[model samples]
Target: MREKLQLIMKHLRQGSLQKMWKQTIWIYQYGRRYWKSMILYTLLGVMGSCVSLASSLISKDLVDIITGHQTGRLLSTFAAMIGFAIANLLVSQASGYASTFISLKVDSEIKNDIFAKMLVTDWESLTEYHTGDLVTRWSSDASNISSGILNWVPNLIIYTFRFISALAVVLYYDPTFALFALLGIPFSALMSRPLLRRMRNNNQKSAAMNAKMYGFNQEAFSNIQTIKAFDLIHFYTDRLKTLQKDYISMRLEFQRMSILTSVLMSIVGFIVSYSCYGWGIYRVWSNAISYGTMTMFLSLSGTLTSSVNSLTSLIPSAISLTISAGRLMDIVEMPQEDYSQDHAVKLFEKQHKTSGIGLTMKDLSYTYHSGTEVFAHASMEAYPHEIIALVGPSGEGKTTMLRLILSLLRAQSGEFQICAGSDHNQKLNMSPSTRKLFSYVPQGNTMFSGTIAENMRNVKPDATDEEIIEALKLSCAWDFVEKLPNGIQSVVKERGGGFSEGQAQRLSISRALLRKSPILLLDEATSALDVATERKVLKNIMQDTYPRTCIVTTHRPTVLNICTRVYAIRDKRCEVLNEVEIEKMVKEF
Candidate 1:
């Protein structure tokens, strides 16, 4: 008791109570949305409990009629007993079905809402969490909240009503019997205080471990190719065994505590139950109450004990719900992506359609959260109908630069903007809403499991076969796609399986081309293509009538000859290279 008090005081000092209160309010908000359904469920449960109470009373009467051999009223009482039993069965099944359906609906809707929010969350903020961790919260934690909202609250109310109703019947028939049934309540309450504190801590550890295990499994499957290449299959299997042992150890520790508490509660319950049974027998021996009345008293006393047990069981469930809410709260409450500039971005696109858009960066500086500076005072430009190149060795922030331009990462201090014309006077600052103005193909096989045509239509969902073919041809992907047995309709397996890496890269480029944004960013997107084909793809972009501004990051100097301008990234800065400088760097390469 002292330890539990100390724990609570510590939490009060740390403001955990305030946090718990906020979580409760968050849960209530979800409950408020489905208040009508919850109210209906509660009514159904109360109706079921009432029917059960009536059945008990009818059974008492039938017992008395049979003992007395009273033929006059026996038939009617037995028939009434049978009808209540059937009614109880029907009500139980209907309510159970309704509860399941309602809970599932709640789960689906909550998942959809959380899934959308996570998609729009700030990319930089989301990078702090692993993919597996996010998924566990999205799936398991969200489910716990949904089930608790529909199940826990209704069960609490129904069980409380059952307890009170049962106690009332026992009191009406014989007040002394109620006292014997009440003997277990004090001991159960005393055991709960410490159990609750321990349960909360255990749940936190258990939830975190669940996330780690889930993340480990997801990553292993996703990187199976790498694992096989390195011949680390046995290593991975051994690691999985270690994690399973840890998980099982944690579950068993909690289970032992639960078992201990259950045994103690059971002891008290048994004592109270037997006392009630003995008192009823004593009354029957003394002829103070009839056998039927004694039987009724015994039944209601058992109901009282079971009902109390059910009500107390909800405490652990409530803790689980709060824990789940806190997990979800960490995710959904982070800074969301700001789309306030969307309307203005669309207007800019409409005005610049004919001339296309260009990019201008001046006096730009950026550093990562880890205090590693990517670049400082960087400056660059890409005019319409031009191909600009950023060349650098590894770890010089080529991909980081693309992320900055795409607004996936924020620069500490800089000017990155898009302009309607090459002169760069007319400009709008870059933001999440500006992402629609550019199409990007990062370094990877970005194809999902779908048809070749479906992959192309990801950027333009309503694209026709002719438009799809045109984009593929522009990216130089038409050669292989046209040769496929199903042509544009051929299926691509997961991670672009059944296709070479270069082919997947070409298809990704094709999807970007289909979007037809004014500006295109290709980060190492063409590294897989042969030099001749790579040069040909860039030429196709330049010859297109859209006046598109193309920016590419590459290590190859072969394509730099066709570029409008080249910028070398090194020494914590971006330096524009002249013809002499470009040639000198090509010789160095």
Candidate 2:
């Protein structure tokens, strides 16, 4: 007896019921916003369940009337049965519609919030999550949570009410049979106890595996060109097959566990049901109850048993929901970047009347989470009306420096100040509101599938054709663009298909130029261009009437010739170079 008690207590705490309830309450609060619909749907469902139970009870009266134990008017009895059936049908339909509508609404709102949060979260922090995992959490896990709110929760409530009503009715006729109904309760609870933890583990594992599969497929398809070039179709196919096999294995294991649990529950159900049958037979044989009461007892016994089984099944559903909720909260609870600070904007406006914005980094230090130092107390300055070049060997924190300037990453200890026209300087930071101060064109193809004009206007939606043409001219792209069939209206495929690398590079620059940000960051933006074209583009950018601060990262000696000053990043230090130093570096290159 002592061992049995200990085992039962262990099972009760296996699935972290406290955490499950917390997740349930969190979802409940989201659903509570549409409380009117939820309440109405639940009430309708309960009413529908009650009406069906009434119809079942009326069968006992019909049997009694037919047996002549109770005299009844046949027409009135049949009409009453038909009325309850119609009422049940109507209530069930209304409940279905209400639940369906509410489920969709909740799913939409939750997805929108998650996507918005993803965009506003800190970049360095957000990069920790895999894209596929984020997508799976928002799509599949979120949908399951919606279904739980709409289906599992309501069914549990309806079944609980039915169980109580049927049990009461059975007791009303035969207390002995009610005791049999009570026997099923403990068996149902026991079946659910060992299943909650297993189900939750299976659910979380399945979700992760699915995300892995998604990420694999996404990467494979996105790099199809490289795969074909390398003649690795068979290699990719075998890898995908391996992922699919693993996914199937997990699913089959979960299904097998489900089957085993169901079989055990069914055994408990059969025992309780047969015991009630035998007891009712003995009662009838002893002339203790009439045929009508015996029939009612048998019917109520099955109903009570089924309701108990249904309620127990909810435990697994709740476990699934809690697992999904935990996955979603992992993202929704991340720290969001604060974007509404007005100090940057206030200073920008105050200094704009005097001069252009300049960037100043003072005693900056940075290290990665893995303890790899990228920069150490590095300081630099870039002013408007001049070009600043960051020259370094690959992977020496040049790109990291640009990202830090863009507010994509933060330094451990440093003051990155933004110097406006006046001498008044303020710390530079990245926020939604302050991001507009700088335009960044990173290395690689950044074009989407759209018309050239549409791509250009993405940053300034209301830009006129005249403004677009001017920006393109400034990037030295207008010459090629005007020669195209539709010029600015020419459609470009994904990643600027049908255009050479140099053309695409120029078009990307044009889009950045359209933004007219006071500060422009070009990270190897002109790598594909020849020396002459790159020189022209760089000259136009610096000599433009806007007098903006331009920061360029490059390995080309010709590109560095036009810069006002150059900073070389080497040996964890950033140092300014004079003409002789630049000449020496150019000769080394």
Q: Whose TM-score is greatest here?
A: 1
lDDT of 2 by residue, 468-517 (tens): 99999988889899999999999988877878888898889999989888
Clashing pairs in 1: none
Instruction: Give me candidate 2's TM-score against the actual structure.
Output: 0.89
Candidate 1 per-residue lDDT, tens place, 388-487, comes to 9999898898899999999898888989999986447999999989999999999888899999998888889999999999999999999999998999
**Top candidate (lDDT):** 1
Per-residue error for 429 in candidate 2, Å, reads: 5.4
**How does candidate 1 fare on TM-score?**
0.96
| TM-score against truth, every candidate | 0.96, 0.89
lDDT of each: 0.90, 0.82
lDDT, residue 505, candidate 2: 89
Clashing pairs in 2: none
lDDT of 2: 0.82
